[model samples]
Target chain A: MGMLIIIDQPPYGTWAGREALDMAFALAAFDQPTSLLFTGAGVNWLRKAQDTADIEQKSLEKNLAAAPIFGIEAILADRTACQRYNLNSEAMIDGVQLTNASADLLGQYSQTAFAG
Target chain B: MNQLHTLHILNKTPDHPRFSECLGTLGPDDAVALTENGVLGLVASKALGLVQTYALESDLSARGLSDDNLEAATIDYSELVNLTLQAERVISW
Candidate 1:
């Protein structure tokens, strides 16, 4: 069964990104199929320009990059959310897919994890 | 077997209340995990009595809180990992 991850936290300034990465890593480590869906403020984590060095927070882009490498087959971000937040597909990390909000994608998952 | 619903709440601000509302949608046997800024809600022991609750110990400690301050049950990362396996469906909001 597929596991759905809803990330509502942004990349920097909080533990949300790290927690999401941890969960993703765990799912990948176990060879479980996992999908990530970015919603609410969490869509900002996909912004390509994130630089946490000035704030001393660890960069999560590496984790984002590893998603595809780890066999996570799908990465989705809310299209309306991205537009509302002034984000573009260009802003996201490579390999992330953009999709409008729909229940079909979510309904397929047997489990969903909300990582804020 | 019944599909378990596990809700992981990460909201911290009491004023912005959706987690509590989401609780109403929970089945009686569902599990709730308080992590990140959501630890604040873990202190309302009277409120969480009816539900199966868990707080991330590392998060609590990072916030300078101990088990003494938590109203719900607290568990380690391993426990949280175990819960994920035990639960048939894990939902986070």
Candidate 2:
């Protein structure tokens, strides 16, 4: 069974979300099956276009795009959250699946993690 | 009577010392939900792996955060209430 890493915070405001991503990648690198689930403001990381130059922070899109190479294949977002923020597949970086946010959906995982 | 699971509600950032102190007290059968600013702790520590963790949807929106990047399940107020009802005890930190 794979581990689910749920991120709910936006990037750049604090290093927490980005750090969480790092942790996920670390787990994946160690050969642990890992999946990323984004909802709420965390979806912002998947925006197709982001301007981080003003903040002097490197864009997270490139790292996110490279997630597959690190063995993270299943990336999902909450459908309601995506709709609330007006984010669709076209507006997001490649490889994100939108899913219905239901208790049953979450129950599918044997272990769950939260890093906002 | 069978003992019910403890529901721990954390409402502070992970850096807060209480966050870890509070987490240290949880048992394997307990459940945890992060609300208010406590949601920040999700990334603050790997201790969350000790128990199932959940995040509040409204709080995340208020903070301009989406679950898109979060590692916690997003639940609404109704779900929160349900969780509370299912637990044998509730504690907030």
Candidate 3:
């Protein structure tokens, strides 16, 4: 009912998707309805077994696990994008709903912003 | 002016996967606006001739690209927002 934040970049390579996640968090914090859509390479952010301990970065999996608690509306992943990356529902962090990031999906939101 | 279907605001470099993905989603009535590193698409893609494309003038200038020889038009910041206003939807890739 508010805005859709699209993440099309893969995690860890650049901070774009991560920053987009921050924006989503901030939006949630302010009680602004926000949802996240992971498309293209951004689908990688949904993978469940990311071990970033060596990379010394915050785990997106862990971060996303806390998304709903922060009041985020939805955690959406593009079906095609997830299929291309070979991520099934079991391999993804829980609570992710698969949907096409089509014009219809975007039309539901008042704003759609891309991250990186 | 006719209402455009979607305005693709791309800022990725040509080599980025999203760059190709963005181009692939273009419809006949869609437009593309290249900004930031996406301006490099003006050099990388000679195949955008069919689409109504625009590059941010400052971004193109910053990259040493002149729209005079390019297939797309160049617009200023205000015109960029106007282009967004003119379109039915926008996808910032």
Candidate 4:
């Protein structure tokens, strides 16, 4: 069965967003079909210009870019969330699909997980 | 069958309660890795008593910590990826 993880928190300020991504990778490592959907402030994780050096935190963007290597093929962002944050596709990492938050889209998965 | 293992990635400093709390949940066969500020946990001379204990090399250097002073093995990004793949579940604290 496929698992969809929905993340709604921004990265770095709190550990929730990073922890959620870790869960997705962990599930994928166990041979479970896993996907991630970024919404709300979570969409910031996809931005390519994140500079964590001043904050002394490791870059979450680097980890997000490595998602594909962990067997997580589906990385998505909520369309409205991008507009809400004024983020364009060019500003994000390559290959993160953008889609609306629709029930039909969510229903495609066997189980849904969230870290807020 | 081989038992499933859980990998605990601690990204917080040792001063945080979750740092110690996470250790109690580890199985004898589980593994732990300290990254980011969590690498500070190794400063204390306590034995983790797990199958393995690791500290991300990049994080250690970023924080100006010397891997030579740590009790855990130093790992790179590739090893971090491998550790996650080797575990059935991962908890970041």
Candidate 5:
């Protein structure tokens, strides 16, 4: 298993931002140690409430809630992104650790994959 | 070649600066995987020229990109997976 990093989010709109997390889960299924970093509008994915019934998409909240079970311990959220979006940490998905997008966090991985 | 050790996976369109910017940084030995929106580069190979490109077969077909348009580089899913294994590192954008 290799380092699997995902950053799936756009500046404004749709579900493309969730692709990174989906890929991360797929990678985890292969026994890879996965990490996720949400930035820009991607941070909205972590917000506590999400319902896909309207668009006929599967519940996104259901998918994100399983990260811990998949062995993904690191879920980094950009502090600036949260501020820009006016999203509070308390409203984020459970088990996700929020933090700034620091060099140390980014450099820790060998490869960085963006899903935007 | 030692330069081929790094495989850069690009998922944006040719219009994306990341495509040009990433290409400029690539050594002659690097291999590129055109997936998602990056397949647009294949459509304009005449101007972009040939620089060792490969399109994810599944993605290209899913997006309705035919072989005729993929004059630059085209490969199947197995080839894409194999390239990743051959690479010392895989960077996706």
Candidate 6:
């Protein structure tokens, strides 16, 4: 893989996670291989049924649903983090693959970056 | 602008790992400029005195934090910009 962008922060609190998502899509637009690993509080991004209207923000759930369409390779959530956030397959959006979020997982990519 | 070798601009809250990660990399010539939620670090620890720390005055006031009794010097946006310009290496964490 060309690069792995690790998103460790939860959505909406800051622009970091959203900026990272945009970076991933920008890379995909150029046909660069990009994967995203949602670990720590970032696993909240994959949880389904986010209602962002009250927050006056775009729904990241809706945005993430378009990842595959953008040619972004994979959406990996840390298994432990998922459990901590109580996000089971049923509670999360479709197409998210769970992994250990280990150092070995990071080694698969030649380059790795933490999302802002 | 201070004569610093490196300037670290941090915006993460104290609870975030990047906060300490930024602190861990500080060299003798390096200084840290805290902005956004990073200004909260001043309330989180006194050990932050180890580094030459500067907190964004605007952010601190917005968060209802008073830097008068805090360990960090309060700076404005222009000073933060100058810090980035002055340092040979700059990192935003």
The list of candidate 4 runs beyond 4 A from truth reads: B1-93
- Relative to the true structure, candidate 6 reaches a TM of 0.57
- Residue pairs of candidate 1 with colliding backbone atoms: A112-B90, A114-B92
Worst 10 residues of 5 chain B by lDDT: B60-69
> For residues B1-93, could you state the per-residue lDDT of candidate 2 as single tens digits?
334489899986654577788898998788889886676565445678777889987655544345447668889878999989989899988
Tens-digit per-residue lDDT, A9-99, candidate 2: 7655567778888999999999988898987767766777554443356767767887999998599998877765566777678888888
Question: How large an RMSD does model 2 have?
Answer: 14.3
TM-score, first chain, each model: 0.90, 0.93, 0.96, 0.96, 0.82, 0.97
Writing each residue's lDDT as its tens digit, candidate 1 over B2-93 gives 45566555444222367567566667778788775565454332455566778877655443344244556777778888888888777766
Please state the Cα-based DockQ of model 6 relative to the true two-chain complex.
0.03
Q: If you assessed candidate 4 against the hidden native complex, which CAPRI class would it receive?
A: incorrect
Model 6 agreement with the true structure over A3-30: per-residue lDDT tens digits: 8999987666589999999999999999
Pairwise lDDT winner, candidates 2 and 5: 2
DockQ value for model 5: 0.02
Interface RMSD, candidate 1? 11.1
Off by over 4 Å in 6: B1-93
Candidate 4 lDDT over B1-93, as tens digits, reads 345488899886544578779877878778888886676556432756454789877665543344235668998878998989988999887
Cα lDDT for residue A17, candidate 2: 79
TM-score against truth, every candidate: 0.54, 0.55, 0.57, 0.55, 0.50, 0.57
Tens-place lDDT digits, model 6, residues B1-93: 447998899888655889888888888888989886676667555557887899877665544354237888888778888878888999888
Question: What is the C-alpha DockQ of each candidate?
Answer: 0.02, 0.03, 0.02, 0.02, 0.02, 0.03
Instruction: Give the Å error, residue B41, model 4.
Output: 35
Q: Which run of 10 residues does model 3 chain B get worst, by summed lDDT?
A: B59-68
TM-score of 4: 0.55
